[model samples]
Target: MKRTDIRKSVHDFVSLRLDDHQAFADDQSLQALGFDTQDIEDLMFRLEDEFDLTAFTEEEDRLLKEAVTVNDLSRFLQKIARH
Candidate 1:
């Protein structure tokens, strides 16, 4: 999938999960948008389902621990899709 499409999917999922339709920047922090641990996990599961990923690798899990922004997740998804 294209990077922009992945990014849009991320944004759409986040907005839908949060029940917020407001536009947010790629650099915007998920925490700042009220994403708790559970919310992040839920998003991950949703993304995995949407992208047909079996599961995240250990290295990817490590990176996910450091992810803070929408762009971070988008980048991660892009990398996963390429593999």
Candidate 2:
């Protein structure tokens, strides 16, 4: 999928998984949506499988350390896709 599509999917999936409407691109702090660290890890795994990429070390770091927004996750995936 294109980057935009992936972005939308990430946002939609995050919203649905977290059961919140506040997971739009602008919503930072996914944890506020009830996504715990485990949930975030699961989401990253799902995204990895969906995108068909072998995750790098930075992927997890980025997800855990700095990916506060859906757009952050989208950009991370786009970065992985590019590589």
Candidate 3:
């Protein structure tokens, strides 16, 4: 999928989960919007289902831990979708 599509999907999922309709900035941190670790995990599962992704690799999980912003998750999804 295209990068913009991936980004919009990420934003929609997050907004739905948080019930927040504000526009998200690329550098905006999810934590600032009240995302906890559990929320992140849930989001990951949703993304996997939406993108028809297989199980994540160890390296990819590690990269996920480093992801703090919408842009980061969007990029991560884009990278995995290409694999």
Candidate 4:
């Protein structure tokens, strides 16, 4: 999928889960928006379904721990989508 599409999917999922329709700017921090472990798990499943791929591999899981913002995840997803 295209990067923009991936970003949109990510934004849509996050917004839907949070019940916020506002567009998520690239700089926004999901953590600041109240994301927690459960939310991450939920998002992982949703993205896996959306993109037909796995997320949060053991390596990626470690990387996820440092991802504090939307852009961080967007880039991570882009990388996965490319491979």
* Number of colliding residue pairs in each model: 0, 0, 0, 0
Q: Which run of 10 residues does model 2 get worst, by summed lDDT? A: 18-27
Which parts of model 4 have CA positions greater than 4 angstroms off? none
lDDT minimum window of 10 residues, candidate 3: 54-63
Q: In model 1, what are the clashing residue pairs, if there are any? A: none
Instruction: Put down candidate 3 lDDT per residue, 27-82, tens digits, no spaces.
Output: 99989988887788778879878999855678457755887888888878887887
Per-residue error for 58 in candidate 3, Å, reads: 1.1
Against the true structure, whose TM-score is highest? 3
lDDT of 1 by residue, 1-83 (tens): 88877888899899996765778899999999888767777787798789886555784576458779988888877777776
The stretch of ten residues in a row with the least summed lDDT in candidate 1 is 54-63
Query: What's each prediction's TM-score?
Result: 0.86, 0.80, 0.86, 0.80
Each candidate: what lDDT? 0.80, 0.74, 0.81, 0.75
lDDT tens digits, residues 1-83, model 2? 59778877787778778544552444576766777778888888888788886668876776678867667778777778887
**Residue-pair clash count for candidate 4:** 0
Higher-ranked by TM-score: 1 or 3:
3
Per-residue lDDT tens digits for candidate 4, residues 14-46, read 888776666667788877788886677667667
Residue 51's lDDT within candidate 3 is 91
lDDT of 2: 0.74
- Best-fitting candidate, scored by lDDT: 3
User: Considering lDDT, which of the candidate structures 1 and 2 is the better prediction for this target?
Assistant: 1
